[model samples]
Target: MSDAVQTLTIVIPLQVKPRGGRKAMVRPGVLALERRQDVTLIKAVARAFRWRRMLESGRFATINELAAAEKINASYVSRVLRLTLLAPDIVEAILDGRQAPGLDLPRLLAGFPLAWEKQRASLSPA
Candidate 1:
């Protein structure tokens, strides 16, 4: 018998890229990509809209009242409420799991252009 042994190697094309606040495992060949929803973001977006509605509906007197009801911090509630002002496409990107790198809640809430077009240009991948 020969002393040498044969070995086989298999490789799947993939890349680790920064898609948002985290690094993502990117598979190249797959036509339909599986993107798991960021539940925290989804919840935040939903809460923002809901809170806005409640306030507009006069169900809550102030952020403090809403915070008390929700058991969240009043300041945090206000910050989250600002999420309502985010551009629709930005919200859509978050929902679709296609948000740009570093597009986390704090990053978005920190500040965004008031203009929808500017927000889109700044937030989305070029």
Candidate 2:
């Protein structure tokens, strides 16, 4: 060993803890709010489909034509037209009506087939 003393330097590394759960968990209240919003959205979608059918059927050509096709009074069609006052996206779909998978027009119409059939049966008296 040399008479002169040797100096040694020791480095200690610092350990860092990971930050825990920064994001807040979704509460039940938040989930309920989301579900309510979805229900409103679906109802609006159904109304849009109904309006689209009316516009595409060419019944809008005249009050008389519309009344004849819908078998409803002319003034009734005019009143129902008020639904167009809804959002533009809905109005556009109604005007440019396209049938798609999720947007099943037939299923929607079929939902009230019994009511329609009843009206038809009444009209065709024996």
Candidate 3:
């Protein structure tokens, strides 16, 4: 054999982005290999609507009572209840696993514009 050496190199194009308070590697024009659905966000949104319906139906006299029934903190329940005010399209995107990459439960729960139009604008990925 000749006293020669050969080298091979490989490169991957990826971007680091913040996803739900965590950093994740993202490749351009590539779909995730696994489910993109955010289970925590979906669960929170579902709970918000369910709580809203319960309150509307007089099933719960107050948030505190609802919180007690759910065994969740009252403050947490209140924060989650705000999800009921999200724009319908946003909710649909979330449920469909097509929400903006940056959108997450913490961002949603932290609060968003009350106006639907503003919400869409504000919640979009930068």
Candidate 4:
């Protein structure tokens, strides 16, 4: 071996594609999987369900009362309460961090079809 200057080259093989408009590197025939948990959305969903439970269990007399106790707006509380009406599978997906790309607390609060089937169809696993 000589202590002379030498150049080296290296090439790494990878496949990059867009997932939900974000680039991801994946192996052939394998989709890039992201289990990145949306903590904000998860907490919002959990709080919504918990709030609904409080009202149903008679722990809170009304949304106004709950809102006041929680230090949040009644209208916002009302909107969050609607999360309880989401399809079971949708809720499960949310809990398990497997919901569709666009599903989030804001989107859910925007409103959805009251029918479970429609909800499933709109927010099915992707």
Candidate 5:
């Protein structure tokens, strides 16, 4: 036998389903699993709050201040403080020394005007 030729055909059907209001809005269980792998907005904010409080309380002033007091880099302290602008839960975890490693605090804070506004509004009583 020299050369051989063969032909193959495949058919696939695709179906699209229209969501029915609120039922469609509900996320599947996989979403919960995914969420567990990441830090939520609340956690970020908490971390920021804790850092801000620490700085405000004169606990850590300059880079040298943090280094002398906590034996860490001044730059690292500054970087961590920026997380206070994030959601509270994040800040809390950091303060508690259990935040997820390498979380991008600044990126998390970006475009979160509503979160900031809500916190600010709450501070001002009706």
Candidate 6:
């Protein structure tokens, strides 16, 4: 065979979607090996647990006190603290990056059902 130059072309299908203020390249119908962790969501959940610990330890007398110590708005602190009431499975999913794709801090802070079953139903993909 005569020597000749050969060119190869490759094509990939994907979509760019925003996740927690950052763009993510998602391949159509492909399962990702890596976890899609959302830093903002994780941080908020962690903060909520930590604040709850402080209150339980008697270090903070009230949400206002914790808010003052953290130098954030009391209402915001209270909202974040409500995360402690989340269903264990939901919290696990959030920590493991397995939460519903549309779930975010804003929707969470908006409030959820106090009942664990209702929370699962409310937060699940519709």
Error of 3 at 32 (Å): 4.3
- Models, CA RMSD each: 9.1, 20.2, 9.4, 8.4, 15.2, 6.9
Q: List the residue pairs that clash in candidate 2.
A: 52-94
lDDT of 3 by residue, 41-78 (tens): 99999999999999999999999999999898999999
Q: Higher lDDT: candidate 3 or 5?
A: 3
**For model 6, how does the per-residue alpha-carbon lDDT over 1-126 read when each residue is reduced to its tens digit?**
979989899998887867569988888653352356667999999999999999999999999999999999999999999999999999988887778888999999999999999999988545
lDDT of 3 at 37: 75
Give the CA lDDT, 0 to 100, for residue 42 in model 2.
Answer: 50
**Candidate 4 collision pairs:** none
Q: Pick the candidate with the highest lDDT.
A: 3
For candidate 6, the TM-score is 0.72
lDDT of each: 0.83, 0.44, 0.88, 0.83, 0.50, 0.87
Model 3 misplaced stretches (Cα beyond 4 Å)? 1-34
Residue 54 in model 1: lDDT: 100
Q: How would you encode candidate 1's per-residue C-alpha lDDT over 18-41 as one tens digit per residue?
A: 766898777873323335456687
Which run of 10 residues does model 3 get worst, by summed lDDT? 28-37
List model 2 lDDT by residue over 41-118, tens digit each: 354455544655766786366766766876877665554444434344433443334222243323333332234354
Q: What TM-score does candidate 3 reach?
A: 0.72
TM-score result, candidate 1: 0.69
> Residue 110 CA error for candidate 5 (Å)?
12
Error of 2 at 84 (Å): 1.1
Task: Give each model a TM-score.
Answer: 0.69, 0.28, 0.72, 0.70, 0.35, 0.72
Q: Give the TM-score of candidate 2.
A: 0.28
Please write out the lDDT profile of model 5 over residues 46-121, one tens digit for every residue. 5546666776888877557755676766665565555555455444544444445444455434433337566434
Better of 4 and 5 by lDDT: 4
Question: By TM-score, highest first, what's the ranking?
Answer: 6, 3, 4, 1, 5, 2
Off by over 4 Å in 5: 1-48, 87-126
